[model samples]
Target chain A: MKPHPLAGALLIAGTVPIKDFPLLLGKAEREGDFLLVDGQRIPCTQGTAAMVTAAVAALDYLNLDPPMALLAGDVGEGRGSRAIYDFLSRELREFSPKVLSLHYLLPIITPMKKVISAVQGCNPRPVLIADAGSMYAAKAAGLATEFDVFTPDAGEMAFLADSEATHPAYIKRYLFEADSKEVPRLIGQAYGCGNAAQTLLVKGVVDYIARNGEILETVREPDVPQMEAIGGTGDTITGLVSAFLQAGLEPHEAAIIAAKANRMAGKYANPTPATRITEIIARFPEAFKDHLCEWSGVCTVESRLRPATGGARQGGEA
Target chain B: MGLFKDKSSSRGRGLTLFKEVKEALKAEKILKVSGYEVKLAAPPPSLRKGCDLAIEVDLMGQAGVERVLRQNGVEFDRIVSIDTEELEPLRVVKVTDFGDSMMVRAGNMKVAFEKATGIILNVSGGGCPDVPYLHLELLNKKITEAPRPCELGFTLCALMLDRALDEGVRIYEEARG
Candidate 1:
């Protein structure tokens, strides 16, 4: 049988407009952080950092001259999420994308559910990335295993830890205090509860890449002070990982590279809390170069610590 | 939370089974001969609308199973999916009348034909392998003279096409009345 025409295509579904961020596109418009792409507006709400990051990652992938077709859609609130499902269903039935990233859409459960069903209904299923609201929705719907990877921050990890809560905000007594310890606890509980996502990139001061609740690697370097205060860093990491997935890297490798590249980008930018997300996004190419060079042993670590270790960080670097 | 749980029994999440044991066995033999993995299990009481024995197969293999069953003359009650949530009902069929032609739609499946001449014009749908062939076979033929979907189709897709055609004819007759 012939393979699908879109076997390795990259399809990004985000709340943010594709045009709003520099995104390395020729033409764009911003409507309150939403990107206007081909006359359709994509929302870049606080919940959609994952997808926004994915689009940024695609820009870096394009630099590699791979046979990649990047398709982006806006799915903010319920409006775009609703339309996205119908479009997604039609696309899945015809062309099979390599990866489908779901950012935001947490507040609107119905549309996200429909998209999950659509993805499941596809023949050669696409690799799914869920972050922010989409991650919450997938886990809440009991369809978390349907996705390939999840990019969740400490707070979201705490939310996944709570078996009873429908949303992260409702997780009891865990808000604003999602430190590194809760990361594995959340993975263990989520796995015990039947989460099928094989890999999780828990974004934090020390990025932990865990497979089935077992911590595989930790990328803790190039830490930029006040990086947590700056928005879209998590989103950038999700995007970077997605790009690596599209490039055919395994989930663990992708997460490690993505975390290292994102931190490197931050270190190069050296942004205060005031540094805009676009400025950080623009540093991705440089980050990718430095991080890849380090991985390939082309670049020496001038600092005392290596970027990633197979287990937890050796010293308090972050 | 049991997304991948082996709920084939509790949820009736497998191939459609028949009330006739012969049909069920025949389906299993045919599927196995076709190189498909198939097993016979007692139907869950909740979903046992037909026979006692049901074929347990992966939901992903449904289209192939249906085609093989239809080709080998194996009858089934209905395909049961273990949906985690109650699915919204299939879209109600809609009939539209043009003075010389008519169109019928049920979900993604559609049937259109000329009213005055009864010449079938098109059959369109996706996500199923049979619909495209159904279009080829039904198109340009008189609706009354065309081969019935039950005779030609070997899967649920063929069943959907039959529904669209049946609805289209019913609406045509009502308009004539």
Candidate 2:
């Protein structure tokens, strides 16, 4: 079955790097932090470049034609941080995005609430993807349940397990140090406290998808051990989940496909500690082909996911 | 005067029904299974048109809940509007200054900050998972430089902290003057 480019827009909220994305090999632009979307410049404040990079990579995989505007923002420090809330409110109200990804906001409490309010006000509530620092914010703000899915690493899994602690830093050492098999224990603990979201994509050596405290599926194939050293891989997973969800896949299917696609992309990149994240992301388009086939169960390619004239990489900067 | 005011009695709008304990419980289960937000409440004695056990449902879910009840053959009394106006109003926050530090209290949440440096000293209150983290992030940071609690918080506890933080900043500015 051919994958469909999502009709609904994918809006990513997170941090950006100190340089403009689509770097020239080893060189970063001398210009300060900013994001270039289709050659238009937007100020990058609080989000990370890794997040935007991953979202772009996922879009490449999905083959979204004439790529839609990616509304990404940086939550600035101090008084400027309020701008994050204002930005989210304005965009969420106007765009009515199908998927709203909350990623990498500062630990400050004020802006977190504002973002939640803006999201709550959105009509036809978006399928929310919360990851990294945003996961902490969502869980901390007690908005974890409001999100459709949470992508947490092993360490983050421990944080989620500790219902007593607000921050991962405060989570009990035992919980954080527990083995992978014990993940179900932590999921139980978090669920007991009503802290867990509707769906959890716990990413590690093994990626497990759990709904309502029950582990539904686990994706463990094509695991690249070295992918751990490469930062932004988790961010890439969040992006893929958002993109897949926008494409109308259920949370369970999206999580599974994203996990498989990410590992597949890493295998394609064949990275060591030396491999940059960008190279791994570049591989998503091709990696998605095989995975989408697995997802659809039909042998033939659908026109929706067919590569464009110039090919997939031409879609956006990953 | 009666303890409750008679508002609109339109079953098409927000309404809940009270049957016997077992029936009410069954209706609650059926409505919830059908995905209606159902809450158990004691219907005001003055309006005791049914059993003591009443299920309060959101106005939007009224039709769906009624349909489910009808489909399940769950018997219920006429639905009634809740006198929302009689509910207690929001609590007012209080601010206290200790010269060296200041504290603001709103409901279950409190935020304290040092006066001289304008940095936040501590944030406390709420059982939500986010409170301890919010406290960790805000602790020992200069209030003026600190992130607004409202932006980072998602629960009533977080909102209360934001309120306290707002007052703490206000008091800090006053102290400076």
Candidate 3:
């Protein structure tokens, strides 16, 4: 396998079948609801495809190298998942990405363990982010703390809070009933049980960024209520955070910014309950442009020319 | 039912409502087998009319209890939290017919099969890791002969797929009859 020396991030996700085996690696582009990569077209309507496509859009907006994607054709069957695990174990040694995001895959413990081991052994260990099935598998296998960040929705958060529950379906009924309002308690339970990563980006009506069991930040502004019901919006937030991490932002910071940017994207999309996730993803560039300067602490030309006032630092120094 | 009439006694407890007493009893059994502290009780008269029962569980274990019931295919109508407001059970399954083929979707998980042969045409959706395994297990096989998704997988997606499979099998059988 050729090395991806310049690859800042790697997205490992699965797509609905198109007859590809092992893995397909390349820069990705969204054409309609399909993610075109390495001479293959993967549907982006949901799951890993939606997440990777949203990440690619954010990376493109930031002018970073498009994420190196490792995709397998999986429609729930373990073939693509097994292929991904095998590829990661055998080929991850050749690539050294700064950010590694794991998305949809079947939660198979043994092979997943090998892949995690391989990832841990990488030189200059990459920042690990897991969402969807990857997060579920990591938490289920008791390896969630090894990752840098976990992006979970309220439903998934309930799973994390119930240390004994291996999957969301089995989370304690009380925790699930608590819903979004009980996220802080769930975060505490997750961290208390050591089932959470170093940081958690909990997506919901109000996005919470927690690190080390402390709620560091919560972003509720630019609230697009309709975004909650839209499939793949949570996936887009994971994608945005992964790109921000690739851009050298701290996990917590990346999570906060991603949450805000996602909402802004939703606002830009002017989404209704009927809006498609792709429509929201399409506004990522504009969303990033609107907030990147402030979020990254970069001075715009106009801000750079502003005079210092009221003991503020000169030259637009935040 | 009179035992639950004292509202204060129900504090910090949630009720899993069911359309029938049998479903409540089944849910209680499933939750107990899964190690949850739950009881089948008559709901307060104000909560429901008729002879239906409710499975009361510690509010703290609601998510886990519900999950176990769902995984076991023991359906309930809804879960009422301590607030007395109805928390509608997620009814995510939908079926679409394409003449020879029929597709059933439960949440993000989808399963489609040939109506006449009961052969699964495709298995798709879901972000769970076991999906690939379940997909491989169900695809290109007769739906009736394949292992049920919940038996082979552990995630909610698998349970949802199992629901789809159940619906698919029912549709296929009814068509043949």
Candidate 3 versus truth, CA RMSD in Å, comes to 13.5
lDDT of 1 by residue, B73-98 (tens): 78887665444222111324655454
lDDT of 3 at B133: 59
- Score residue A310 of candidate 3 by CA lDDT: 20
Query: Model 2: how many Å of interface RMSD?
Result: 16.1
Give the number of the best model, judged by TM-score: 3
Candidate 1 local Cα displacement, residue A96, angstroms: 0.9
Cα lDDT for residue B139, model 2?
63
* Full-model lDDT, candidate 2: 0.59
TM-score (C-alpha, index-matched) for candidate 2: 0.55
Score residue B163 of candidate 3 by CA lDDT: 80
Residues A259-313, model 3: lDDT tens digits: 9989999999996534567788889878777777777676342342121112122
In the order shown, the candidates' DockQ scores are: 0.01, 0.02, 0.10
Model 3 interface DockQ:
0.10
Give one digit per residue, the lDDT tens place, for model 2 in A34-108: 445656454322123445555555554455432243332222221222344457755565556667776654334
Q: What is the TM-score of each candidate against the true structure?
A: 0.53, 0.55, 0.65
